[model samples]
Target: MSRRSILRIAAWPWLIASLAVLVIGFREAIFLTPADAAQGDIGRIFYYHVPSAMLSLVFPYVNFLASLAFLYWRRRDPLKALAADALALAAAEVAIVYTTVCLLTGMLWGRATWGIWWTWDYRLTAELLLWLLYVAYLAVRRYSATGQTQTIAAVLSIFAAIDVPINFMSIRWWRTQHPAPVFFGGPDSGMDKTMLPAFLWNFAGWALWGTFILIFRYVLERRRQAAEQEAALVAIEASLEISQ
Candidate 1:
């Protein structure tokens, strides 16, 4: 079978697996997991909120690395550069989706726990900035001239990645309305033992879902590139016939 055929077939299993895992994780998180002593039932939002936020960062880093590879290989190896560019675009789009979820869930959780839906604190501000930067990245990629779009978008992706670190470190670096880190915030930070399993299941499930989305996006991008190339060839041939 052709490579495209194989990829199309492979995507189905990944999609099914991701859906199954996410459904199970949702059940475990919402029904099986114990509520927090402090935040009560509202704390249940943590299961989905945290995982989405974490993956938001994860995929932006993926985009940055892919952008770096694109920049390095762009002149020397067109095929490698194209693959890297496609991966960068796919990662950026997926990251935006995750970040949107993170922001909305965070707002809802904040309203429940903090009595407010929005704040200009370090973490919140940084997270908003992260989202805006990537939205701009997508706009640039979408609107720039074909010859320059990939290079410009790659540069933007790399620079925009600086916001990821700021978003991650904001809680540690500055006091905020957001809760302190539960997993890696030194000796005083941790989650309840009972909640760990649910969290892990959700994290694994979301990670798989993100991977499937990324792959699907990459495949679509490859097809788009192929279509563009075909259109360009057709235009060139028509122009040659006209000149003859």
Candidate 2:
């Protein structure tokens, strides 16, 4: 199958599996797992909030790496570079989706737990910055009519990439209003084992869901690129015929 038409999305395997996993996760999160003794049902937001936040951090790297691949191949192999650019664009879009969820859910959780919708905590601020950078990247691609739009976005993505580690490390490095690390911060960190199944299942479900989204978007972008190229070619051919 052609790269432009190879994605047989009519029967997406990941989509069904992700939905199933998400159903199971929802059950576990809402019915199976015990509520936080202190926070009650509000704590359940962790299942969605944490997974989206983690995946948000991850997809930026995918964007970053794909952007790098785009740069490397833009001159070497145009087709490969186009594919990379599509992937980069798709990843950036999905990153926005997940990070938006992260920020919104976090505010929901924060308001319920902390009685405020937002704080300029290090982690929160860093995450917001990461979101803004990707937003800028997309804005540049969408609005910049220059042929160098992709190149500028690619370079901008590098700066965006630098923030992933910073955002991840913010909580670790500072005593912020955000909660401490749940897994790797000394002996006192980590949730009850009973909570693990819900967290893990939701994490798996969302990861699969994110993957499905990324692939679907990438395929759509490739098709779009293909269409645009065909249109440009047709225009060029029509111009040549007129000149002839």
Candidate 3:
């Protein structure tokens, strides 16, 4: 079998496993976990929202790193650059999807818990900025008129990565509307041990699912690149034959 075929085949089992984990996590969150004392059942949104937010933050780093690789290898090793570009594109698209889910779920949770869909809090606004950065990255790749589109997007990715630290530190630096860090907000930061299993399961599930998507997308992009190269070769050959 071809490499792409193998990669495509491999993705299925990972998808299945992630789906299984997601179902188990959903069950644990909805049926097993008790309601929060302060927030009540609306707090269950934590399972979905928190995981999505974490992944949204993570995939951008993937895009940023891949973009850096693309920039380094673009001229030195064109094939490697194509692969890196494929990975970067895949990562950015995935980042956008996860960030959208994060924002939507946050809004839903906010509406339920805070009685408002959004506020200009540090964390909320920082996360929004993060989302917009990736959207612009994709837009640049999609619509930029310049031949240096990838280079432009790669530069933009560096700036996009800068926002990640700000978004992460937003809650830590200034506790406005958003809550403080759950893992490191001093002695009383962590969740209950009983809540750990559901949280852990959801985190794992979403992460695996996201990886499967990234790989699947990379494969598709590689195939497209191959097709474009083939078309260009055919056109070149036809032109040469006509001249002869």
Candidate 4:
């Protein structure tokens, strides 16, 4: 099959699967899940909140790795460098989306649980810094000229990866107002039986959704690159014709 034909075939299945998972996950999260004894229905947000936070961290790491690949191959291999740059762009864009969602959901959850809209706590601060770093990364890609943008952004991405560990460990290492880890917080950390299933389902669903978005974005980036190359070729041919 032609590449376009293959993409068409693959796209529909991915869209359908993503929609099905998200819808089912939403239903389970909002209806099937029991309310937290302490937080009530407000706790339902955890289903989305946790998954977004998880993906926010995960995608940036993906970007970091892509950036490293770009840096290593950028001089020796143009095709590999282009591929890596495209992946880095895709991953960074998706990571920013997830991080935005994570921050917004976190603020909403905070209001519900802590009776405040925002705080400058350790984890929150670190996460905000992480978000800002990626925003800057995207800005450099979007606003800067093409020649040095990828290299500079790749270096920034490598530095930005440092925040991921700090954000993850903030709750454990510092006296923060944020809640303790539920998954790996030792014996004291556990979820209610009723909440666990919904949380897991939502987590899986969001993960799949994130993956789909990354793939879709990467495809779009590749198409854009192809168009640019075609346009450049046309411009070169026109210049040669005029010079003749």
Per-model CA lDDT versus the true structure: 0.91, 0.93, 0.92, 0.90
lDDT of 1 at 88: 97
Give one digit per residue, the lDDT tens place, for model 3 in 139-243: 998899999999999998898799998988888788598877887778879999889999999999999999989988988998899999999999999999999
**Segments of candidate 3 deviating more than 4 angstroms:** none
Lowest-lDDT window of 10 residues in candidate 4?
194-203
TM-scores, in order shown? 0.95, 0.96, 0.97, 0.96
By TM-score, the better pick of 1 and 2 is 2
Q: How do the residues 24-107 of candidate 1 rate in per-residue lDDT, one tens digit apiece? A: 898988899988889888888899999999999999999999999999999999888988999999999999999999999999
RMSD of each: 1.4, 1.5, 1.1, 1.3
> How many collisions per candidate?
0, 0, 0, 0
Encode model 2's per-residue lDDT on 1-244: one tens digit a residue.
6543445754366688999999999999999999999999999999999999999989998998999999999999999999999999999999999999999999999999999999999999999999999899999999998999889999888987899889888889889999998878788999999999999999999999898899888988988999999999999999999999
Question: Distance (Å) between predicted and true CA of 180, model 2?
Answer: 0.5
Stretches off by above 4 angstroms in model 4 are 2-4
Worst 10 residues of 2 by lDDT: 2-11
Instruction: Tell me the lDDT of model 1 at 106.
Output: 96
Q: For candidate 4, lDDT tens digit of each residue in 85-130? A: 8999999999999999999999999998899999999999988999
